[model samples]
Target: MSEYIPLKYYFDRDLALHLADLIQSEYPRFTITSFVESVSTGVENKELKARVEVIANTLKQHLPTDYEEALAILLKILGPENKTEEGMFTNGYFLMPVAYFVERYGLDHFDLSLHAMYEITKRHTSEYAIRPYLIANSDRCMTYFQNWIKDPNSHVRRLVSEGTRPRLPWAKKIPPLKNDVQNNLSLLEKLMCDSSRYVQKSVANHINDLTKDNPEAVLTWIQKHISDNHGTNPKIIKHGLRTLIKSKDEHALELSRQVEQGV
Candidate 1:
C-alpha cells in the first residue's frame, strides 16, 4: 500500500506554478515567474496555514495592489467552472489560495469581499475565509447568510451553515455564534430541509457543533422536529446527535430512539 501525503503539501511549488499558469493564461500581463518565485521560497517547510499565507502574500505582490481589482482579476482567472457532482472536493482544490487571499485582504471591503467570496465559492469554497467576516461584522454577515441560504449553488448554500459553525474544525471560532445559541439556530431553521444533501450535511454538522456547548438545546430541537414532515428532519437530527447518542445522553438517545428507555 502507498502512503498518503498530507493535504498541506498541495500548496507547494507545483501548486504555485499551476496557479500562476491559470492566472497568466487569462491575463497576459501577469508575471507568472515572479509569482512562483515569491510563493516557492519557505513554502515547503510551513504547515497548512502558513503555506496559505505564503501564497496569499505572494499573490498580493503579483496581482493588483487594489483589493477590489485584485479580487476581480483573480475571479476572471478562476473562470466559471463548477463541480458537476455533489460532495466532490477535487473539482476546485486549486482555488484554495484564492480563498486565503480573500481572507487576508478582503476585511476592509465587506460588500466587495462578500461578492468575491460568492463567486469564488462557486468554483471552490470561501467557508474558511468567510468566518472572519462573520466575526468582524456579525449583523451584516448574518444578513448575507440569510440571503445566501437561497443561493442556487449548493456550495454557496452549504457555506451559510458551514462557515458559521462555532467550532468548525481547521477554522477559527465565531464568538457570536458560540455565545448566542438562538442566533445559530435561526440560521439552521432556514436550512433544516435544504434540497441538496451536500448542503444538508453542513447543516447537520452545524447542529452537531451546537451540541457540544448546549446539549439540552439540541435535544429539544431534535424532539420538536423528529417526526415533522415525513421523517426527513429525524435523519438530520440523528446525524447531528451522533456524539450525544454515542455518549449515552439519556434524552438524546431516547429522542433519537436508539434506546427504548424513557428519560
Candidate 2:
C-alpha cells in the first residue's frame, strides 16, 4: 500500500513545481526556477497554513506588479471547477495559494476581488479570503453577502454564511459582524431553509457562533424560525444550539429537547 501523506504536503515541492508550470503556461515571463526554489526552500518545517502563506507571498514576488494582470494570469491556471461539494481541500487544493493571493492583495480592488472570489469559490473556497473584505468594508461586503446568499452555487451561498461567522476557526474575528447581531441573523434567515446541506451546515455554524455572544437573540430568532412553520430544517436548529445546550442554558436545553421531540 502507498504510505499515507499528510495534507500539508499538498502545498509542498510538487505543488510548487506544478504551480510554476501552470503559471508559465499562462505567462511566459514567469520565473519558474526562482518561484519553486523560494516556495520549496524551508517549506518542510512549516505547517500547512504557513506553507500556503509562503506560496501566496512568493506568487506576489514573481507575478507582475499590476495586481489585476497577476490575478488574471492566476485565474487562467484555475483549470476546472470541482463539480461536487466534497473534498475541496483535496480535489481543488491548487486553488488555496491562488485564493490566498487574492485575499492578501485583492483588498483595494473591491469589484475585481469580489468577482475573483466568486470564481475561485466555485472550485475551492473563498471563505477565509472573503473575511478581510468584511473587516475593511462591512457595509459594502454585507451587500455582497445579501446577493450571494441567493447565488445558485451552493459553495457561493455557503461562503456568505461561513465568511461572516462570529468565531470562524483560524480566522480573525470581525468586530462589525459580531456587534451587528440582529442584522447578522437576518442575513442568515434567507438561508435557514436552504436545500443544500452544505449551505445549511454553514448557516447552522454561523448561528452557533452568534449563540456565544448573543444567546438570547439567537434563541429568540431560532424560536421564530421554528414557530413560523417555514419548512426550515430541524438540524439547523439542533446543531446550531449544540453549544448552548452543552453550556446547560435552560432555554437552549428546553428548546433542543423540544426539537428532538418534534414539538
Candidate 3:
C-alpha cells in the first residue's frame, strides 16, 4: 500500500500560482506574488482544513477590506461550472477558500452570504461553510434550506440536507439539531425522495448520523417512510439503518428484512 499523504499537501505553491493567475487575469490590481508569498510560507505544516483557512485569511488581507466588495471580486473571477471529472481537491479547489471566505466574513451578511453559498456550491461545496450560518441563524437558514430543497441544481438541493446534518463529518456539530433530532428529521423528510442520487445520499447520511444518538427515533422514522414509499424509501432506510443493522438491532434488522424471525 502507498504511504498515506494527508490531503492538505495538495494545497501547495502550485495551486496558489494557478489561483493567482486566475485572479490577476480578472483584476489587474491583484498582487499575485503577494498572495502566493503569504499562502506558501509555513503552509505545509497545517492540515487540510487549517491550510484552507490560512489561504482564506490571506485572501482577506489582499482583497477588498469590505466583505461584500471582496465577495463580489471572487464571484466575477470564479471559473466555469466545475467539470465532473475534476476531483474535489483538484481543479476548482480554489472554491474551498471561497467557501471559507463566506464562513469567516459573510456571517453578518445573511442573505448575501446564502446567495454566495448557493452559487459557490454548484462549483465546490459550501457544505462546511453553511453550518455556522445554520447555527447562528437557525430559523432563517432553515427557511433558506427549505427553499433550496427545490432548487433546479442537484448540488443546491444536496446542500439543503448535507449542511444540516447533526453530525456532518469534517464539520462542527449543530447543537440545536443534536439536542432536537426532530428538527433535523423534518428537513430530511422534505427530501426523502429527491430525484438526484447526490441529494438522496446526503439525506441518507444525515439520517444515519441521527441513528447514533437516537436509534429508536431514526428506526421509527425509517419504518414510517418505508411503509409510505416502499420503492425508494427502502434504499434510504437500508442506508440510514446501516449502523443499527450492523449492531444487530432487532427492529432495524427486521425492518430491513435482512433477517427472518429470530435469525
Q: What TM-score, over all chains together, does every model reach?
A: 0.90, 0.95, 0.90
Q: What lDDT does candidate 2 reach at residue 125?
A: 89
Over all chains combined, what TM-score does candidate 2 have?
A: 0.95
Q: In candidate 3, list every pair of residues with a backbone clash.
A: none
Pairs that clash in candidate 2: none
Over 1-263, each residue of candidate 3 has an lDDT whose tens digit, in order, gives: 98886667878787778777877776678898899988999486888888898888888988878898888888876767654523555555777888998999999899999999988888888889888887777888877877898878888888888888878889877664536878888888878877777777888898888888889887787667666653445677678778888999999888888322212
lDDT of 2 by residue, 60-147 (tens): 9999999999999999988787778897887888889899999999999988999999899999989899888887888888888878
Candidate 3's displacement at residue 135, Å, is 0.9
Question: Over the full model, what C-alpha lDDT does candidate 3 score relative to the true structure?
Answer: 0.80
User: How high is the CA lDDT of each candidate model?
Assistant: 0.80, 0.87, 0.80
Winner of 1 and 2 under lDDT: 2
Q: What range of 10 consecutive residues in model 1 has the weakest lDDT sum?
A: 254-263
Q: Which ten residues in a row have the lowest lDDT in candidate 3?
A: 254-263
Which scores better on TM-score, 2 or 3?
A: 2
Q: Over the full model, what C-alpha lDDT does candidate 2 score relative to the true structure?
A: 0.87
* Best candidate according to lDDT: 2
